[model samples]
Target: MSQSSQFKAMEDYFQSLLNEGAPEPSRAEPAPQVPVPAVVAKPTLEKPRQAELEQLLAKVPVTKPTVAAPVQAAKPAVPRTPAAPPPVVWQNIQTEREFQALFFSVAGITFGVPLTELGGIHQLGKLNTLFGKPAWFAGVMTQREQQLNVVDTGRWIMPEQDATPDYQYLIMLGDSAWGLACHELMGTEWLSRDQIKWRDKAGKRPWLAGMVKDKMCALLHVRELLTLLKQGVNIDGV
Candidate 1:
C-alpha cells in the first residue's frame, strides 16, 4: 500500500478504538450553572475643538526651515566643424614638381610633413605633466637640454574620440618646441604637387595643407600649424 493509504488505515483504526472506549453521559440530570456577569463599557473621549487645536499649534514654531538644492556648473563652449569641407590654403603645393615629405601615423590616421617645413624628430622621453592645462596637451618632454611641448595628436585632430594613442616619436614643428606625438614613422617620400589635393583656402582645419592622393593622409601646413599651436588651439581651431 502507498504511504498515504497506510496512514489513512491507521487513522481509521484509532478513531474506531477511541469511539469504542468513549464515555457515556449519566441518565440523572445535574445542577443548573450560574449565568455570566455583564461587561462594563469604557468611557469615550471628546475630540478637541478647532479653536483649541489652533491654540495648541500656535505653541509650536510657525515655520520649518528648508534646504536649497545644489546647482550644476555650465560647460564651456566648444568650436564646431564646418558642415561642408573647407577650401585649402596652399595653392602652389600641388604641381608637377616633387617635394620630399615625412609620413607618420597617430592612432590610425596618417599625416605628411614637408621636408622644407620639418623641424626635428625625437623618440619619446620622460614627460613632465602640469596642472590646469587643456586636454589636448600631452605634457612636456625635455630632450638634449631643450624642452618640447607635446601635443596629444589623436585628441587634437579628433576630439570627439578623446583618445590617448601610444606615442613612439615626437615630430617637432619648424623651429618650435611644439611636437606632435605619433606611433610610427612611415619614412620620407618625394611627392609631386599634383599628387596631393591642395587646399586653396583654410576652412575648418587651418592646420591641414592638403590630402595626400596616394596615401590618403593629411598634409600639414607647418606655418599655419605653428600659429595655431602657439595660440593653444586644436585642429578645429579651439
Candidate 2:
C-alpha cells in the first residue's frame, strides 16, 4: 500500500470540498407569496374639461336683456278766432251833382248836415242852462217865434256825452242863427260829389267835411260850423 494509496487520494479531495459549500438543495415548491399593491388615492376631477364646458353651456338657449318703453310727449293744438268785416255797400253809381243831406246819430257816430246848411226843423223846446253860454250854448229855445240859440250837437262835437243824450230835434243853422241839438233824425240823403270824401285839411274835427259814401255819414262842415258859431269860437275845447 503505497501509503494506503496516498490516504486514499486525500480522502477524495475532502469529499469534493464538501459538495461545493453545501446550500443548493431545495425541492422548488415554497416560492408563492408576492401580494403588495394597495395605494389607491385618485379622486379629484373638478375641471374635467371644465365640467364638459358647463355641460355644453347648459344646452344652449338663454338670451334675456331687453327694456325699451318710455317716450311720450305730443299734445298742443288749439287756436282760432277771427270773423267780422262785411258792411259797406254802395256799388257803382256814377256821379252827376245832386244835393240834400241831414242823416244823424251822435254817440254811436254817423253824421251828415247840408240841407243847404238848414234853417228849420224845430220841436225840442225847454233847455235853459246858460251861465257863460259857450259850452256849446244849449240854452234858449222859443222856436218858430225865434229865441232858438240851442247848439249842443253832442255838445258841439264830442265834448263827452257818455249816454244821457235824449235830444229830439232843433237843427236850424243857416244864417248863424244856430240851434242844432239833434240825435237820430236819419231823414234826408241825396248826395254826389261822387258821394263825398273831400277832406284836404280839417283832419281831427274842424268839423270833418267829407266821407258820406252811401250813408256812412260824417260829412258835416255846415260852413265850418257857421264860421265857428260866428267867432265866439270854442273850437271844441270842451
Candidate 3:
C-alpha cells in the first residue's frame, strides 16, 4: 500500500458520518530542547582533632633509654711481717765456758749483755716517775708483784750527749730490780772467751766489761752495773 493512501484511509475512518465534509486539522510543530551545563561538586576537607590525637598518644607506654655503669679495677693485697718473740739462751759467762750474749742498741749505740746475767726482758710499760732521782734515772715500772727501776740507758751511758730517745724494751740486770732501757733488742749469739776482749783489771767505766771486737760494742758487767745502780751513783760511779 502507498504510505500516504494508508494514512488517508485511517483518517477517513476516524471522520464522523454526520459531518458532510470536515476540514483536515492542521498538524502542530514540536518545540526543540536546550542542553544543560555540567555541574562539578567541590571536595569536602575535615580539620585534625588536637584533643583526640593527644589521648591516643598518651595511651601508649613510653620507654626511657637505659644506661650502663662504669667498671672499676681492684687493688692487690700487701704482705706484712709480725714482730718476733724475745730470744732465751741460758748459761752464765765463764772463763772457759762458751756463752750466749744478747746485743741491744740505745740511741744508736750497741751493747751486749750475757744471757745468763740478763734476768728478763720486758716491753716498756707505764712508768711511775719519782722525784729527787738522778737525771739518767728514767722512772720505775712494775711487773708481776715486783718493782723495777728503769735506767735511761742512753742518758746514763752518754751523759754528755743530750737528746731524747724512744726506748722500746727494758733489759733486766742479773736478778736485780734494775733494767736498762734500750731501743732495739738484737737477738742472742754464741761467744767464746777469746772472742771477747776481757778486762784484766777494773777500769773507770766499771759497768763496761770490755769492747767486743767483732760486734764493736760494749760488753756489760751486770755485777758492777747492779752495784752502781744500788749505790745510786752515775755510770762512772761519780
Candidate 1 local Cα displacement, residue 8, angstroms: 99
Which stretches in model 1 have alpha-carbon errors above 4 Å?
Answer: 1-96
Q: Rank the candidates by lDDT, best first.
A: 1, 3, 2
TM-score of every candidate: 0.59, 0.25, 0.59
Q: lDDT by residue for model 3 over 54-106, one digit each (tens)?
A: 77899999999988787777677677787797763322335446888999999
| Per-residue lDDT of 23 in model 3 | 71
What is candidate 1's lDDT per residue for 76-173, written digit by digit as tens?
97989768877553433333378899999988788999988889999998889988767888898989889899998889887777758578999999
Give the alpha carbon lDDT tens digit for every residue of 19-83 in model 2.
Answer: 88788779889998999999999876678887998898999889999888888877676666676
Off by over 4 Å in 2: 1-71, 76-96, 101-112, 115-120, 128-169, 172-197, 200-202, 210-238
Worst 10 residues of 1 by lDDT: 87-96
lDDT of 3: 0.82
